[model samples]
Target: MSSSKAGSSLLDGSGGIQPISEPKAGPRYIYYRIYTKQGALESNNPIYSNDRFISRIVSRSVAPPHTAACLKKHIFRIEKFELSTKCTLYSSLSDQAPVEDSARLALRGISGPGVSEIDPVVLVVDVSDAKKRSKVTSVEAKDLVEWSPTRRYVYYRVYDEAGEISSKTAFDDTDSCLGRVGTLCISPPYTALSLKYCIMGAEGVSPDRVCNLFEDEGGENTMKDGDTVALLSDNYPGVSKEEPLAIVYALQKDPVNPSEQSNFTKKLIVTVYGTWGDYDHTWHTTKAGEIFHTDGILLKKPYVTDSEFACYAAINSSGKKAFIHQVYSSFG
Candidate 1:
């Protein structure tokens, strides 16, 4: 796996959380370590299992880079002939392709009732590795019932014996690496396709609108790159009045450089939208973040804007996603 050389902070979002003191001495202790440019590349990466190397992992197609990359589905496909023994393939920790990594995987084993016959083990450096003078701690396989290694600025789920994800680790301020928003692109309008609205009181009555970005120079959607664009209302002419007002939406993408064409790593953004008005605000749509190909960049979250505005998803020239929003002049 390639190490990230770009400068970034270690999950600076949560200012209230204090820095982890050190690796506590115990059977099971959670340790936090930061990997700067110098320490990013560990001697052992792409940890293998049963002497077989972990290759390509199934990743969701995402657009532009620096958006939140969802490590959703990782299927380890190994030909029957590749396996020297009967074993399930586990994914390597980082988002990097195993074909690119030549490092040897440090193998460990845990034998118990539910453990796979050829289960894979993770390799983590002692906290002291980050702080040379600090005391080195050991995390044994028995003590660690589950270990999800955070790498490539994306956190993944811990897999159980059945190859099912036991639990998902959300992005936070305490991880080995940190992610940042990448470049922004705004050009060549794309289509919005459709919009579906669901209200609390109304069950079987959802509304759909045919909306397009029409994103030319000096367009109605006055949004810039990285700004949170909320689709506030169904202001379209033929829209029904029964639909609720003050709806908000935010679309987020994964981390990938748009300028780099060879990077097949597709970018997919989750469109999370809710109502933002008064104190009665509530979430209307949960899983609305779907990316369509129209050629553009993807929109990411944390809605860092100088003022409030509404946003919509569009596309660029390369069939990637983009974002455009309508600014509320009063906020400026």
Candidate 2:
């Protein structure tokens, strides 16, 4: 008989009572190799060992077009069954409904003497996980002071403490409230003059100097040659007066050493009149394409839990089985 047939016969009824080798005692481990979908897909998948929850494997967006990357290896030490257990894969998407069989993965532990021996696994999620991480957080809005006013806009200095921020809202006059000197509503059709004054004031640059930088003969919609553009605007209710309306600006980097800049390249400025739930606000830029945020709270709050904003979780390859956290979907 061939080696395969002979091996099968060893487990047959006629071969009963054959001598067997005992499993070695002591520590054992299972290492995993999981493969996600080809593009950047956001996923918050949990991993289990021996039917017990051990860690969560999350994929991050490293590039555009659904391309994603996840933990290379998951190492779990045996606990009850000689430091080894069968590993089954599960994703948060399964919580919604019955997951397709093809989306699931089943892996059996392979035992070895030490670090050299390991069990590898590949897991796939039922749905593509593509949620971008939120960068909004609680902020401290201090004061608002006027700077310069153009023919169609007025500039003001906004004093803000919580520098970097984010928002999902579209930039519009509605849903936003910019506190004017009269505490009047600075709503839609936001004049270029209003945007310029706020940003120039925030930059501590003289509002009158705006004319020196650029000239605009065009009406409300046309931005001056060197004038800042409004990016996003919204009104966030429940904001306390102590932390009133704020303007978050993302400035251009100093080309010499861009790496030294802060993550958001942000500057927080306050509006002159204190902003309330109805107070409107707008984020402005001297040039187009620079990022900015408004009408949102800070990323971290005193009472809110981390899970609310945390979008990605990665498992450490060490024996401790530690977890690493990353902000939003940009993979680290």
Candidate 3:
């Protein structure tokens, strides 16, 4: 090669082409301001006459193209500003057309060389409906109150079985009880099941175990699972620590299998303690003079009657069917 000048070489000693360095570019940004008003747009008064200035927003130039709706939502999220359902954004005080949600900011001359820190694009919002909503929300918050009910306490006693209280000896003897006497604090509208659970917890018994609750110590006037505690107290008043309500552990009977139940039929010899006849003529009647015999009796179905007690359907000895009041007959 010809004699190469010391400073004329374009390549380095590695035989690779040398690259030229360029100057670094500065960061770019879009700047804008927001203003809000709480009334209808007026041409004579002008939107910027008495408008309130919100925070100024600065966005990077490299960000994706933004629409009016997108920018409004972003401002709402960043500023935690609430807007009403019916509101609109305007580019200038004199602008007759509102900025559409899909309209691009760049296309609308909101962001470009014309926009600057001193002469930034201004966004105006009409929040007349928003003011109404805010007022309503404030009033509702001021009127809100917490719900609280008065607490009441009730005392109860537990027995091993119904027979224990039936003889009245268990009521007089503390040693005859299944557990020590317990008290329950109840609020109105409490259910009987909830009371049972409280008693079960006090007696240290399993929750799955069944317990029968009565309003009286004699175990009469049974309390159903759905009965309200307030109603039960109304029916039987004057329950105190000296005379507490009675609770008995129900005897657990083995469940009859469906297959065995299908192959077998049960017949009960019921004795009528009083003379009763079905006034509705839907079923037969029973006379106290004769011992009524039935082939099969359906006791599960609830018969609607004026009597306070429940009624059951039974087939009489003469093959006649009738509904019998539960209190008039004794099943053997």
* RMSD in angstroms between candidate 1 and the native structure over all alpha carbons: 24.8
Question: Per-residue lDDT of 1-332 in model 2, one digit per residue for the tens?
Answer: 57766676678646345667876443233232322211111112223222111122222211112111212223221111111222223232112122233442222123321111122222332111112222232222222222232212222223223332322221335423332221111111123343434344334443323121112211123343222223222322112232233443334332222223334233223222211101111111111122222212233211111223321112111111111111221221
- What lDDT would each prediction earn against the true structure? 0.23, 0.25, 0.44
Candidate number that wins on TM-score, 1 or 3: 3
lDDT of 2: 0.25
Q: Model 3: which residue pairs collide?
A: 283-321, 283-322, 284-321, 284-322
lDDT tens digits, residue span 49-154, model 1? 3212222221122122312111111111111121121111112222111111222222112221112212222122222223442322242334433324322111
TM-score for each candidate, following the candidate numbering: 0.15, 0.15, 0.26
Off by over 4 Å in 1: 1-100, 108-332
The numbered model that scores best in lDDT is 3
Worst lDDT run of 10 residues, candidate 1, spans: 182-191
Q: Which scores better on lDDT, 1 or 2?
A: 2
